[model samples]
Target: MACQDSDTARLIDVELDESVGRGTPDVEHERAVAIFDLVEENSFRPVGDSGEGPYKLKLSLVEARLVFAISRENGEAVVTHILSLTPFRRIVKDYFLICESYYDAIRSATPSQIEAIDMGRRGLHNEGSQTLMDRLKDKIDVDFDTARRLFTLVCVLHWRG
Candidate 1:
């Protein structure tokens, strides 16, 4: 017998809105990485539901807000949460700026300088993830790593119209 981890919620399927434009290479790459990481390991448990999952999630932006439509593998709805984008505006802006700096640093700056910028980027990323966890509280239960991956996906959606 082998012990398997059951604490993390695995995403069996994920879909992003079709209306979102195909962004730059960097943006697309970020989306890919985030989705891959999210599907690989996550902690998602919808409140007030008896369903156990490996969940399916549809992520999109509607009327300037972010939405998560979660369901079981059987296609039954678990819960839907719409989160305001207002609180994330400043943090997203800062993340983008730091990301640009980090990318440029990778191309031209010294290794030490790049490391410094990367540290700042990671710090801002953590802050955004924490904000996400706070907002999702009482709605859905998710761990920090899951929140971080979801935040990346949200940023990808935010990058578009």
Candidate 2:
């Protein structure tokens, strides 16, 4: 993945909206938020360090910290990643799992959902695109397409310091 600065991308900050079409749904968005917060507090470890869930990110400014996790709901893997900067990045930004479970099942997702998820992942510096999504894919060692779909369910949680 390549790393490039993105001036066009805007970090998403809406409170979880379900998809409108044929893609994964957004039923677990709220639980994902809670889970992300929990993982951030108790499971901050560098990637490849061991175990699973609550994996640490590989890139960041010295003063910043990035973390991630994976949650399985109805067999779908929701990948979550968080970025924290002590000085603050003007405003706290959050990227949520675009794909989630609901109605005891997943929701009907859309291309827009994929775009939303992709937007949140812009400017990542990994072997594929430096997006946290790509990193998660590599760490999990899954196929690119599946890794992507799995990552949308990945959530991000935050606390101001």
TM-score of each: 0.87, 0.22
Please list the residue runs of candidate 2 whose C-alpha ends up more than 4 Å from where it truly belongs after superposition.
1-29, 32-63, 68-130, 136-138, 144-146, 153-161
> Each candidate's lDDT (Cα)?
0.81, 0.32
| Model 2 per-residue lDDT tens digits across residues 33-147 | 5444433332122233233332222221223544434433222334455544332222223221212222112255576765655554442211122243344433443333322
Model 2: weakest 10-residue lDDT segment is 3-12
Q: Quick one: best TM-score, which candidate?
A: 1
Tens-place lDDT per residue, model 1, 1-161, is: 11123542567677777655688887778787878888887777776566578788888778778888998888888888899989999999999899989999999999999999999999999999999999988887777888898888887776742
> For candidate 2, what is the lDDT?
0.32
Kindly give the stretch of ten consecutive residues in candidate 1 with the minimal lDDT sum: 1-10
